[model samples]
Target: MRKRFLVLILLSLPLGSFSQDINFELDFSAVYWAPKSNDTIRISVGNNGRYIFTDSEEVAKSFGSITRRFQPAGGKENADLKLLFDLKTIFMLMEVKIGQNTVLANVDLNQFMKKGKSIDSATVRKMSATPTALKIENNGKKYKLYGVAPDNKPDDLIYMAFNEKYPVDYDTYFSKLMTSATGELFSIDIPSGLLVHVEDSKGEIILELLSIKKKKQKGSANIQLKLE
Candidate 1:
C-alpha cells in the first residue's frame, strides 16, 4: 500500500506542475545610432503576458542602406523554420525588466556558428549598452532621446515627437513596420553609405555592419546559406 501511494504521488506531480499556467510578459526597446553619419533607428516590442513570444514595431529612415536581422532565444540559427527572417548572423540585443531590476543581454552570434569559426571570448562581453540619453538625427532634423527602455510609454512619446519634428506618412511607415516585425528570418538589404539603426526584443544584438566587409569565398557559400 505504501509503494502504491508513492507511485500515485509521483504520477500526480507532473500533472500538478503542468496544470499551473506560467504567464510572463517581456518588454524590449532599442535605438541604433551612427556617430559619423548621424542616423538613428528606434524600435519597441511588447509581449502580452506570454513569455514565449512578443510583437514588435520598427521605424527606420536613413540616407543609404541598412540590413535588419531577427533571432529569438536559442541562437538565431535555431529559430523556427517557418519564420521568414534571415538566420545568417543570429545576434540580438535584449533587455528584460521583471520589476525594478533590469537584466541586459547581448547574445553572441558566434555560438550559433556551425563548426570552425573562431570564437572570441571578448565578443561575448561586448553586448550590453549603458543606459543614457542620446542625441539623434531623424529626417534631417535633430532630436534628443533616451537610449532603449523596457516600457512602451517612453517609446510612444518618442514616436509622437518624431512625427511632430518631421512630417511623414505614418500609414505607409506602419505598413513597412509590420512587415519587418512579423518575419522571423527577414533581412532588409539597405543601400551602402546610408546610416541605419537596429532594435531587437531578444537582448542579443549582433552588429553585422562592422563585420560586413569580409567577403565569403565560393567554398564557404554553402555553409553560410544552410538555414537549418
Candidate 2:
C-alpha cells in the first residue's frame, strides 16, 4: 500500500519540477561544401546569449571555457535590452558581430535559405518524417535529451524534432540560425521550458546542449547590439 501511494504522489507532481528556469550552454556544428573543398565550423553558446565560433576544435574548446561579460557602453537605462528577443515588443532589426565584421540578420526566410545548397522536394519529404517522442529523464540537477537516429532526411528531421520539442510561434527561428545567432531566438516562448539543443532538419546544421546554470543578475551598464 505504501509503495502504491508513493507512486501516485510522484505522478501528481507538477511538470514544472521537471523543468526549472535556468541558463544553458550549447555546441553547434555544420559542414559546408564548396566547389573544391568542404569545411566544418563549430559554435558554442551559453544561455546568457554569449557565443563563439571557430573552425578548429581547439579554439572552440578554449572559447567555450572562458567567462564572458556583456555590459552597455553608456549610462543608459535598459541600454542592453535585446529588442528582437524581448518578447514584450514586436520583432525588430538586429545585428550580430562575427570577428571584425558585423552583419544584419533581420531578413526573411527566402534570403536565409539561399546560403545553403538547394535540396529537392523528394529530399524534403524524406526529412519531414514524424519525430519520435523524446524521453527526457530530468533529475533535480541535470537533464538529457536523446539524439535522433541517423536517417535520409536530416534537415526535415531537425526542423520537426526541434519544433516538436521547443515550439516557437515565429518561423524566423531558422532565419536567425542562418546568421549563426543560435541560442538567441529561444529568448521568447519555448514550450519545453528550456532549450538545450537544436539542429537543422537537413543535417547541414547542429546545436548541442552543454550546460544549464543559474542566471546571475546584471549590474547597471549600458550595452546594446549596434545594428546597421
- Whose TM-score is greatest here? 2
- CA lDDT scores, all candidates in order: 0.25, 0.28
User: Model 2's lDDT to the true fold?
Assistant: 0.28
Q: Against the true structure, candidate 1 has what lDDT? A: 0.25
Tens digit of per-residue lDDT, candidate 2, span 1-228: 111000111112211111112222333322222222233333332222332222343332333311121112332221111112222121222332323333222222222333333432222111112334443222233333334322432432342223123223332242244222321212222232234444454433344333333433321112233347
Most accurate candidate by lDDT? 2
In model 2, the runs with Cα more than 4 Å from the true position are 1-131, 134-155, 159-190, 199-205, 219-228
**In angstroms, how far off is 29's CA in candidate 1?**
7.7
The alpha-carbon root-mean-square deviation between model 1 and the true structure, to one decimal in Å, is 21.3
Estimate, for each residue in 36-64, the C-alpha lDDT of model 1 and write its tens digit: 45444333222311111211222222201
Residue 96 in candidate 1, Cα distance off native in Å = 24
Cα deviation at 184, candidate 1, in Å, is 25
TM-score of 2: 0.26
